[model samples]
Target: MQLIAHRGLVRSAPENTLAAFADALSCGFHGLETDVRLSADGEAVLFHDRTVATGVPVAAVTRAELSHLAGYIVPTLAEALDAFPEAFWNIEVKAPAAVAAVQTELKPRIERQRLLLTSLRHDIMLSMAEALEADTGFIVWHRPAALNSLLYAAMPHAHLRTLVWYYESIDLTLLQQANALGFRNYVFGAQTDHEHRLCEEFALHGLITDHPEFVGLTVTPPLQ
Candidate 1:
């Protein structure tokens, strides 16, 4: 199973910062996943939330200006690519428009093979899939909801892949369902023997957790 460091090995460093990504690389995590949002000033910054008390969106500030913020400076997508040239990037674009901006920045520096473009928005995913060629893969971040809803519209398509970001428990049936469809599975810190059993049963493509060292490591039983 591929181990993807959620938020760039968040255990060692601040989440989604250059420091976190560097730590993930040093520790040998092959793929790094992070969220992107636009700052008020039109700069694309690496951040997860919609807004903070400062009343400013991440995109509003440039990397240089955001460096002084106490929370964490919103980094441009470009900065991340520069920081880790060889790493596989799982970038979740918060807004559909961000995809175009990201592509514009990424195209000149590296080829599309190293990146996986993804979004929860089906329209955005479709737009990106349409804009880019077949080689550039698009993944859909999945959530639990009514099966017939608008969000699940992309699940039936072959090109659309599913990435589970968060979960309270490991439901083997769900993982099996995902596997049956040939979609990749991701779980957050299922660092236990039981979870491993589920992972093994489903043949997960990848696992995400704050602790990278425990990945693929056997989870020993607790004291009786």
Candidate 2:
């Protein structure tokens, strides 16, 4: 199974920052995943949460302001992509507000590297699929919900080629269902040693993990 570092293996540095991304690369992970949201100033910044420690909405502040409150530099999507041209990217557009910004930011970069864009919002995935020929995935939890998205994609021929399931929701039946439809099955939130061990026996297309070392070393894909 392909192991993609979740939020660049966050430890010392906050996730979605250049520092965390660098740490992931240093650990020999070729694939890295992060979340994107738009700043008040219209910058497409790499951040996972909707609110900060002060409970202020991330969208309410400019990137600079957010950085100051966050106490660490928050890297923009372009900056992160530029810094890690060698690694495959799994970028999750975390909020609806980020959809437009992410599209604009990624338009020029998609063709430059191997990447997968995912979102829990079907509308965002549909929007992306319609806008670009790049691979888009529906992040889902329940089997019926995942099947619903698959059905829609099949009839309309969407760019959706992958299903990103929550780790707790994964089961043999679900994996079989995804494989039967010829869709890539990537599990998110599988970070602990127990979680990694549980996934070891399953044939997964990829895994979004915070602990890459425990997931066993899968062969890294060739970089674009």
Candidate 3:
């Protein structure tokens, strides 16, 4: 199974910064997952939340403003990709608004086979799958039967083959149902060893974890 670093490591540096990501890579983690959002200027940047500490929406601020308020260098999606060219990335586009900017950035990099673009928005994931082909996309953070009826119907099951579910939302029955539909399962938000062990018990395909070096995990390189 693949053990991707969640927002890199958050050990020495703030989460999602280049410094934190570098720590994960230096520690032998080959898969890195981070959230992507569009700045006010339409620049694709790596950040986790919809809002900052002052509750200002990230989309309302330019990248420079965000960096200053955030108290850390907020790296662009391009900068992260360029700095870690060899690492496999799970770039979760956080909002529908980011899809266009992200698509533009990813189009030329498609041939690298090192990216898995995921989103909580069904339309966004489906759009990427349709545009970039199936394997490069994952519908994120939901149980299969719980997806929006209309939106799920619009999803091409044969094209998009994977789901990245929150750890709490998944169980064997849910996973079985998803597998019945030909979907591969990956669990996210697993921080403890027991939680990580639960993923192993379910025979999950992969998982995203804050601590990639946790015990009982094989921590293999990501699919390239």
Per-residue lDDT tens digits of candidate 3, residues 30-75?
Answer: 6889999999988999999999999998999999999988998899
Clashes of 2: 0
Q: Candidate 1 on 92-158: residue-level lDDT in tens?
A: 7878647767767766654544676666665776666556542222342444553235225556455
- Work out candidate 3's RMSD over C-alphas: 4.8
What lDDT does candidate 1 reach at residue 51?
53
RMSD of each: 5.6, 4.6, 4.8
Model 2 TM-score (2 dp): 0.90
lDDT score, candidate 3, position 218: 38
- Between candidates 2 and 3, name the one with more favorable TM-score: 2
Clashing pairs in 3: none
Off by over 4 Å in 3: 134-158, 216-224
lDDT of 2 by residue, 154-200 (tens): 33645687889898777777688777877888888776788887776
- Against the unseen true structure, what C-alpha lDDT does each candidate score? 0.64, 0.82, 0.78
Worst lDDT run of 10 residues, candidate 2, spans 215-224
Each prediction's number of clashing residue pairs: 7, 0, 0
Candidate 1's displacement at residue 7, Å, is 1.1
Runs with alpha carbons beyond 4 Å of true place in candidate 2: 145-150, 217-224
TM-score of each: 0.75, 0.90, 0.86
